[model samples]
Target chain A: MTVQTPGLIATPKPRHAPALRLRRLQEISLGYLLLAPALIILIVFEILPIFYGVGISMCDWKTGAALGVEGWQRWIAPCVSFIGIDSYTRAFTDPAMWHSLLVTATYSLISVPVQLGLGLLLAYLLFQKVRGQQAFRVLFFMPYITSTVASAAIWAFLYNPDKGLINSILTRFGVPEIRWLSDTTGIFQVLLKPAGVDLPSGLEGPSIAMLALIIYTTWVFVGYDITIFLAGLGNIPAELYDAAKVDGASGWTLFRHITFPLLSPTTFFLLMLTVIGTFKAFNHIWVMTQGGPGDATTTASIYIFKQLFQLNRYGYSAALSFILFFIILILTVFQNRFAGRRVVYD
Target chain B: MNRDKLKSQLTNLGIHAILISGALFMVFPFAWMILGSLQTFHETTLGTFLPEQPMWSNYYDAIVAMNGAKPCVFDPAAPLDILTREKGCMIVRYFFNTMVMGLGTVLGVLTTGTLAGYAFARMNFPGRETLFKLLLATMMIPGELTLIPNYVFMVWFPTPESWIATALNLPNAEPHNWIDTYYALIIPWIATVFSIFLFRQFFRGIPNELFDAALLDGATHSRFLISVVLPLSKPVLITSALLTFLGSWNALMWPMLVTNSPEMRPIQVGLRSLITEAGTQTQLLLAGATVTIIPIIILYLFLQRWFVEGISNVGIRG
Candidate 1:
């Protein structure tokens, strides 16, 4: 939501209104007092840390600084010195950072489209005057509300290569086994290798681990997306469909003209959400593989988290995070300028 | 006409097939996790969806692995045989700590959120509109990066005892580490902007006549908040509480960062360590994960309408 300010000027005093200024002053002070608790927390926890993080990013901080000289033992605190843009340059040049960025981009590029298509299809199906659709909607949405870590763990068990349900089912069907989460090789590369052909590195599809996570994410979120799309579909007028039907419009033509255009706002909203979601995706990835099998699924969120927590590279991680923030800002601004104009808001 | 009827019947059958199978895909994991929790460690493998004999002991073992001494003969630190090595998990403590954190966070958020929301919604004050906009604008700053700074702040922050002692002019007033305390877990997430926004939006729907009447009776803003506004705002308050409680309970990375002690860790973080410790033991892992999510799942099932309304109504903003 954008910032919305309604300027309501204080009313001028009426001639017969006795001592109204005191009441007005009380109102102003009381409002500020009421707002103080939330404001103080946000400023200390959110606002201050944002500036503090920026300051940290400008410095040479690798680990904790020695804060004492009591014999051989020393108390350590976070270390920093002004190094200015070095961490940013390093983050850009780091191969690990680039790979993680590529992974995130590739993931969003593939998963968001697939999620949209599947979500739309489900919404359309559920939108029809079908029996038991209400029950079906609840059943489908159960996964989205469940904890991501818990769901991912279940998927992990199901993806176990030796005794997993998926592999067992595949073997029963006479299909060879697939290492679902453990396999790091790109799916296209693996498929093409058996045929004695090669897909170029950058052109290769996501790794099997990435695909598994994608499947998990789709299963979790597609229902939520469908809910949104159904909400959008609910807004359309039935008379338009009736009139189109009377005019010999049918099937794809009906959707192509009326439904699709009317659903543009919802579609655009879901697109931005899905893109941003995939970029900051962490919980599912962390649970399923911990971005595992040689960093196959270590997207930007995971990478920056490791820098901040695992390696204790605060300054470097801060720099990496800002890049991510910058990218999201640009994407949001670009979407607002282009897609926002096209969305048919009622 | 006969041919068309048959085609329509077939189409209906096709639709049922697709929908049922899709739903089966959606539901099977949960059913499996429940079943897996019932199975013993050896029976958790594939091709064995059902246990040979329903192993009720898995839950016991799971509880023991949670580091609680429930239904057990000895302490975890007590000398034990090889079979008793699994009794050392601190799960009950994790649950206690998590509940404490969750309730604490909800109280903090609701208190702050409702107060600010009511003030912004009902109060006419100078710069109220401008300040609210500024609050919303603060949301533009991405939060994931602030973890380190927050962690450092927690580490360096003066302990409550130290502050109290300093204020009271006590002789011994050394700063104690607050890293693993409940304050560190609850305070950082005590107030969220989204909750405040949700509360504000809900409060705005209220008519001004009620407040004006209250004002005529010399009711202050906080008085109206306590007596009139809050009583009428059950739905918003419930939604806000549930969201905050669930969010805090399910939080992983932050709790993981702050609380390294098993005594202080929350259920999710505890579940993580359980997974790591359980290794290939799917029974224990699934059982622990199942325990971790059961509370929220039960809450969702009972308050299905409230939860669904919360999600969908919030979606109205987007």
Candidate 2:
């Protein structure tokens, strides 16, 4: 080089050559190709269907009819002529819809708290280093895995007033038989009769049939909550309990200070899930009650379903669905804003 | 001090007793279903916990009935009439249909989800992040929102509208009604956002170094994915597959909606029909339930460790 062979010409370094852009492009293309099947299906089946639903909600679409011409002109145009929030107005004014909402809210209110409470109690007991812990866990979890229809069928039989095991057992103990599924008598009224307390007529509460459903629902889901709590318990460091014991904290104090705060995240998660789950409950009602005994068990979901399928009011059903969606969204957002802040992530 | 300790021990024992009783309350229904399944028709109605004699024949009868077997009657006068009748239990056919649908859904989910997940995890590409975020956002939209539109689509997709029938010189297309077909059950479930999201999270946790090293050795991307990534992701794969299978196997609504004929019904819907038909046939219903549940229970038993681990993993990630 010093001898001026190339007049300060630099030698090319092979390692320093830019990686092939074509190779990177090929790699990315291959990745796209690999992902395309799922992406395409999701877009077609799920995402497109959602947008289509919104569009269908705008127009009065009927099943088993032509779209955009005859069917639209007949059913949809007239509806739209009357429809600037008219469907929503009808939904609000309709007492059946309001009753359904009330039923759903009350069901959620009663069922969610009871499930969480019982589940926590069970989980806490199971968490103790006891013999046959695994067996206990399996037994608790068994119901969660069973098919909803099967469980409902079993519960339906159990609640039979005539020859049901429950009524038979009650009779043996000199207690009055209950009309479990058929009775429209509010549980409060039934309780008052036995307790010699007169509840106000309006404050009779959820019907006995609805109460049976609530109990069944709570029973089925307690295992799921227990599983969650058990996981949370497992995550809590043993050292914290050791430290608390050393400082003379025990029982309620340790639970309140150490356990509750640490478990808050799990609790929040469960609550959010439970709320969403309760609102969207369909299978149980569909299988067991079919929103029956004068629509006492009919939640918003069943109402929406009936509107669409049975009544052929697709637009109205869609409107109800969107309204329900907003309710869920608002509640979830509110929970996230308030409760989520309290959830300490360790 | 010793007396106080004894008192505490006694209290603990009492607590355990209460907890054990509560556990019994939780588990009794399933136990009852099992026992009920073993009992005769008479015992089932009586609600007896223990049968005087377990009728193992009930299971055989159920199976024979499920298989559409007719009782061979010794009636020569109406021999042909009896011979042609299909009297086997329709439950067996429904069970088969459910299994096919469940397996189909599991396969579709696994294949589609795994590939998509691997791409999301390993590849750097344009719009990848945006697309994933969109997928996650779609999950927020409840399934109820799309129910009507989907039903409409199922009804109307292949068939031409009345207006279209008049416009074209071609004759109006026959209604290739997709309802009750395997397509209706299989197509809608093929794309599951939850499965995709789950698989993506699991795949992302996999190390990139192995893939890179494989690539450096001149292996292609597909080659590396198949040889390297697939081997490492067995647990997650099993978890996803099992979850997908269970969800499909237990599904009641979508199948119920689409399939109108009892012949096309899955085991869940069939069981529902059975419940309605013979509301007092507790033993038969329990027998049906036992058949429905045994497969899942066996699956869970074998894969208990994986299920617990996978569920916990999902809880953390999801």
Candidate 3:
């Protein structure tokens, strides 16, 4: 699930009294009337659109010119022919699309672990009693709350190859300037080139540009993950630590045996979320790199966006969205089946 | 005891070091942005930490540039009409536009969410359970998947006039221009499931006797909602309003897609064009970024207590 409405509500006494009362004409009418406005808006705007989306995905729909100026009329009376799996098959053969999948997969693969691991570590670091900790929390959480475009804009300037702070710092250490966001060279390939090591074509890791993007992503979300983890840490009864300490449990031992086990559920949740977040990350990527430096950072979301908005390929974008959807669904299911069981609930 | 004190001191020092450094790292981009905004265009990429001379004029120019083609100034010293004008003062206009969208979204969400949430929690309705479960299920659907279809619908959905005319056997009627309207920005965003879920959850906390008492007093459901539930749900209401306002305020993709004209565009759109369109104008771009984020930051700072509780509760409850 993208969002979990997990908090339970208190069960009222005399359950379904209102429900039973609804057998009367006025009561039933009131019930429907109460729900009608919200329901109508939701259905008309959100729910019906999903079915409409799937319908569009199946049809060989083009721009408004082809489908008529008032496109909803086309939906009323049919004109477009059903493409029938053509979009999906075309996606399979399309190299740019496949490479985009690779980039998105790699981004998720690299960024999720880094974010989760560092986020967990930071959570532990801040979980300790510290002076002015609240200030730190506010500062760290700012990025998560701030507009991604603004954050990405700031980072874009920071990642400037010629004058960015990172390169500036690197120069002070007597290192040559390194192209940050502009560098399409795979990090591994760049690292290995001095030693005359060459990897095969497909195994060349993610580009430096992607790494820059990932770093920005990590910075943006690390605080969020830390905040979540801090809450998780707070949930662990302090008595466990106290009792364990009384029994001669050291910091490492307590964390290893008690804290780690108890915190696994939150850790797993953040991990899954970070991965899902990476797949959907767009505003930052769009603002920062536009998935650029020669398609080195083009994630599936960005690719789908370009198709729909830039190329006017609505049907194709819809198809790509479904493909991405199935991938996420399958991955989520896979994680739930295999990895979710490892989470130790408190 | 001395050893333990020393160890604790060392640990606190270590914690402070790490926390402070991390905070600095997180905050540096914002600092840099503010600094960069004040620097001249050439000086921005000079790898300087501070501006040679701070220029507030970047902000003035950014406003003048984005405030539309009409020449305008926001100077308080300027005449009242200059401040009030909509033509060339697009930054102000977009700012107002975004605020309207934000307020409209919050109101729509609150009204609809409370109604739906109340009905679901307190009232009995046919298919209510199924509809709610369906709502929850729809939550899983990726919002990006709905983008194209929603866009198409907004652009070309049958106008109410056309539909009514057809039903009434009238000759002709024009379609509603759903896109680039206040409705476009505010309508689709109103049915926020999470907010509805939140209201419903909070509503469930109200004791059954409250409703029973209200019923005894001849209060209708709306009356109960207004007099009792709404008054009691200040925390949830504030949190919901803040979150919805923030979401709508920071909205980039949907509004960018729907609104094409300058006056209709929001701050986020203006901020994006400030970067993508006028790429080399780093000072103005950074200034635009700073200006764009300042409102939310101010709001967040003001509501820090509730916002923190909201954030923590969201994660903890999840």
Best by DockQ: 3
> Which residue ranges in model 2 land beyond 4 Å of their true spot?
A1-34, A61-85, B1-8, B11-15, B38-47, B60-89, B119-133, B140-142, B156-177, B207-224, B260-263
Task: Please state the CAPRI-style docking class of candidate 3.
Answer: acceptable
All models, DockQ values? 0.41, 0.39, 0.45
Arranged by TM-score with the best first, the candidates are 3, 1, 2
Q: Which digits, one per residue and each the tens of the lDDT, describe model 3 over residues A53-106?
A: 677677676643475645345433362578877888998999999989998999
**Total clashes in model 1, counting residue pairs 3 or more apart in sequence or in different chains:** 5
Let me know the DockQ for model 3.
0.45
Better structure of 1 and 2 per TM-score: 1
Candidate 2 lDDT tens digits, B229-276: 888888888888887787887888788877887667788887767666
Q: What is the lDDT of residue A88 in candidate 2?
A: 76
Per-candidate Cα lDDT values, in order, are: 0.79, 0.76, 0.79
User: Model 3 Cα displacement at B314 (Å)?
Assistant: 2.3
Proportion of native contacts found in each model? 0.46, 0.47, 0.54
**Colliding pairs, model 2:** B65-B89, B68-B88, B69-B88
**How much is the TM-score of the A chain of model 3?**
0.86
- Candidate 1: misplaced stretches above 4 Å? A1-27, A63-80, A235-258, B1-15, B68-89, B120-143, B159-162, B170-174, B206-229
